[model samples]
Target: MKNTIFTITLILVGLIATSCSSDSSDNNLNTAESLQAVTDLALSGTWVISSFIESGTDETDDFTGYVFTFNSDGSLVADNGTMTVSGTWSVTSDDSSDDDDDYDSDDDIDFNIFFAAPPTFEELTEDWDIVSRSASRIELIDISGGNGGTDTLTFEKN
Candidate 1:
């Protein structure tokens, strides 16, 4: 009788463990989906350059009064209240190059901005690291510039 009872207890424990594992997997999936949704929503909006820092110097006024519109289809339009320049933008995962397996690291996302227009706007292009992001703001940093200068760009909803 003791042997049978011991067998039943072991089986029950295994079943409970499996159930808990399944729930944890589901929770992880939900978390991933939520994060992606937040990123998408934050990118699809009209933003203005609230702050622009290059090589530790401020250059926010370079884009003053300009509004950048990021469409869901990866198209971007920058309007300086007179003329508009078209471009493309995309957000991608940078996990492949991550040195560590830390899933919560901010360096896991790459915010790429591309433009082909007046030379002035070219400075705003790069595959930047997503330092931070929210519903009303996004902060990006580029540390791989050929000039060995770091660039930080902050955009706030307009």
Candidate 2:
């Protein structure tokens, strides 16, 4: 009877540990807001795209020489000397979909970006999950629900 009880307890502990473990996809989920109280303030000022990957392709060249300004008032600007694009950006934890919060949307915090003009710049638009962040660098990733493709974006303060 003593051996049986000890085995049962060990099994229970194993189960609890397994359930608590998070996979790679969930590693950075919902970290955007929790790490910083004022996300807008943290993201304010100018940034440049250090790296951008789209569908297994290196597309960072598309944004080369461009400077992005994330305004506190939800405004975004990208100027590459000759051309300038305007858009909006935000950091939010609202993961609700059309079917509401239960629509298989994890509680992942998102660094949302939106640019309307210039086809190349439009591709930067996505609700990217914050993978890592620091005073000078912010890394983001997004697994496309429609295509299952993984895209990554990195920004460095300039």
Candidate 3:
């Protein structure tokens, strides 16, 4: 009868909805894994600044031809054809802390760069949030630079 048909239709709709929801969650997991793979491959090579923004101003020209090399041992060397600057570099996942069970790593990755002396690239040394990353490039953002300005840095693998 009509009652049985109505019940069957409702059940079918519920099953379809449940199946779609589960697929989305699986897709999210896959995206996270893909991003992590890209980060691992991108970190060990010579890179150059593709874009640099400080306080809403483009400063990419200042670092033209400068090469930055990153090693697996947390060492970094910046070579500008004339001089070299030594520093350290690292990337931390947002959920790396053991105490934060509710933390989500998909949206909270951070990149750190430290220098011993004055760096040729101003405001480049900071704990920056990874906005986006790929096997050949990484986009970073520092919302707080202690100078009330945002810093954006992008590096492309050479």
Q: Which parts of model 3 are misplaced by more than 4 Å?
A: 1-39, 95-105, 145-148
TM-score of each: 0.71, 0.69, 0.66
lDDT of 2 by residue, 53-151 (tens): 999999999999999998878889999999889999887765454322222232456678999988888889998777777778888887788987888
lDDT (Cα) of model 2? 0.77
- Displacement of residue 77 (Cα, Å) in model 2 is 0.1
Q: State each candidate's clash count.
A: 0, 1, 0
The local lDDT score (0 to 100) that residue 29 gets in candidate 2 is: 47
Candidate 2, clashing residue pairs?
30-109
Worst ten-residue run, lDDT, model 1?
98-107
Off by over 4 Å in 2: 1-38, 95-107
Q: Give me candidate 3's TM-score against the actual structure.
A: 0.66
In Å, residue 137's CA in model 3 sits off its true spot by 1.5
lDDT by candidate, in order shown? 0.77, 0.77, 0.74
Comparison by TM-score, 1 against 3, better one = 1
